[model samples]
Target: MQTAQTVMMVRPAAFRANPETMKSNHFQKSWDGDLDVASLARKAFDDYAASLRAEGVEVRIIDDISSQETPDSLFPNNWIVMLADGSIFTFPMEAHNRRRERRMDIIADLSHDYEVLRRVDLSRYEDKNLYLEGTGSLILDHDNRIAYACRSSRSSEVVGREFERLSGYRIHWFDARDRLHHPIYHTNVMMSIGTRFAIVCLESLSSESERRELISQLERTGKNLIDVTFAQMEAFSCNVLELRN
Candidate 1:
């Protein structure tokens, strides 16, 4: 089967225009420009999502509840993935604010179209003091049975392996770090996989061995590598959604 034509985008509760996210070299910053951050964020969110819809995607737009003070609420994929098979896996987030982002009502809302095949609840990991943000942790090549992940508080071996066990994917695990030697919080920040290609910043992987491993996984899966520099990755360039067309 092919990928879904649906693209899900959460409206930005904390909308603002930030230059930092436009390029990868710097830490993506919060909006401090003349425009009201919230307003700009809302416009950007709408425009990007509208662009996707224009491409014939079946987009589901959910309004963000801003009063709750959830800054990163716009990135919905961190919380859920509505599989074509109808299974919904709600992720356990490392950040407290994100926990509110998942509402069963949202899943219930989606049940009308998608079949709920499986529910893999890892939120208990939060009590155990571990985490793994859904697609943020794992870049899955759905058709190829491959999953690429970088270990972080939101991406742990225990949870990642558990997902593999349920999804039956081959895991290619590695440590990804930034220029300062700190681990990248999300694998999606450094790379993304499309049906035919990948956009990645290979240098972000601290170890030569891990870099090799990442490249090997991509190559073995027959993905055309569209390599980006660490400069590009930080721009959230790797945080892409390959929607159903």
Candidate 2:
């Protein structure tokens, strides 16, 4: 899919470390019950939005309602996704609070610029404990119609197949583990795919066959693979995202 020149962000109102999500999310730290998390989160949110605007990118910031208390609202890309053909997808979130992050008003606002042909509601799968947290669960190689994913607590083959059937993307999945041998929570946290470049933590893929498949696919797709070690992936090197200017 073509990258959007415009991006959407949520201004957090009750942002804090989520207890339920912290188990799978390695980047999240448990708050020691002392810091002014809300205020700090707001400042960071504002600064990040300002930086994006400085780069000549249009950012649509939607204020998160306090009633929702969605701690991960800032990561809107997890609940909602927009396809190149104007298909809007609402995914099921692993955490209950994260599910509240999905807002129909945002879709209404986005429709002003993008043609929303239809909505694919995969939230029903959550009832079965089959979670697929939007772009967080699957990284799309849109041009090649491939959905790259690493199965974990928040993502699964059941929902991955659903995504493939609905979005018309082929699923390419492998098991990825952290240095501690724990499953990586989200696929986006371990790999990123771009038009001409791919950054991945090959060490995370324990199976050599899976690692080779990932490399072979990247090479076949004409992407320059930038391999990173487990330590580098911990530094957020594999968590790269591309934006259109």
Candidate 3:
């Protein structure tokens, strides 16, 4: 169960660069050219879904609430994670507005198709200011039962430990920084783990030891490591997802 055959996506209703997330997510920028950003986003989403469906992938598309003002709701993966074992985990988001992206109705919709044995809600940690934004903060190697996460505002060690305890997956924690020396907001932005391969930006690791350890672990687990440069990482070369068709 390293990869999923079915995936969920949210159609943007108010698709614009979120100011609340921009502070931590350096990759995001405000829309300068106004050609109807929401319209363009919708078209892109439709094309992406169509392409995935053409590839024999099951894509569940959900529409965002227009009045919610949750611009980043398009990324549903950050708030909720569904495991192959019928376990659902809800994460605590760092961005205030992003927190609203989590909807019980979506979970209910999913329950109609999938058997949800248990749900672990980690949003209570948000009261303590500890956040771990689902797959955004952690890159999971489900087949190997290993989780990789980089230290960042959105990814906290305390919450990571809790995730490890709840999910029964060992986590390898590391520090990663962008080219500008700022902590990489999300681990997914710097690395991705597939069934037999890993795409990572080794240059993003702040510590040499951490970089070596990550490489060693990936190699030990029989993963073909494809290293990318900082520039390529910034271009989202590492932010990739592998799905089973």
State TM-scores per candidate: 0.89, 0.95, 0.98
RMSD of each: 3.5, 1.4, 0.8
Q: Candidate 1 regions off by >4 Å?
A: 15-26, 31-34
TM-score of 2: 0.95
- Higher TM-score: candidate 2 or 3? 3
For residues 44-156, write the lDDT of model 1, one tens digit per residue: 77798788888888788888777866667787788886555556787877766668788777787777666776777778788876787888888878888787888766688
Best by TM-score: 3
Which scores higher on TM-score, 1 or 2? 2
Q: Candidate 2 — worst ten consecutive residues by lDDT sum?
A: 1-10
Per residue, candidate 2 scores C-alpha lDDT tens digits across 99-210 of 8888988888888777889889899988999899888888888899888899998997998888888889998899999998999999988899988899999999999999
Q: Is candidate 2 or candidate 3 better by lDDT?
A: 3
Error of 2 at 215 (Å): 0.5
Show where candidate 2 strays beyond 4 Å: none
Task: Give per-residue CA lDDT, model 3, range 12-82, as digits (tens).
Answer: 99989888888888888886885899999999999999999999999999999988889989889899999
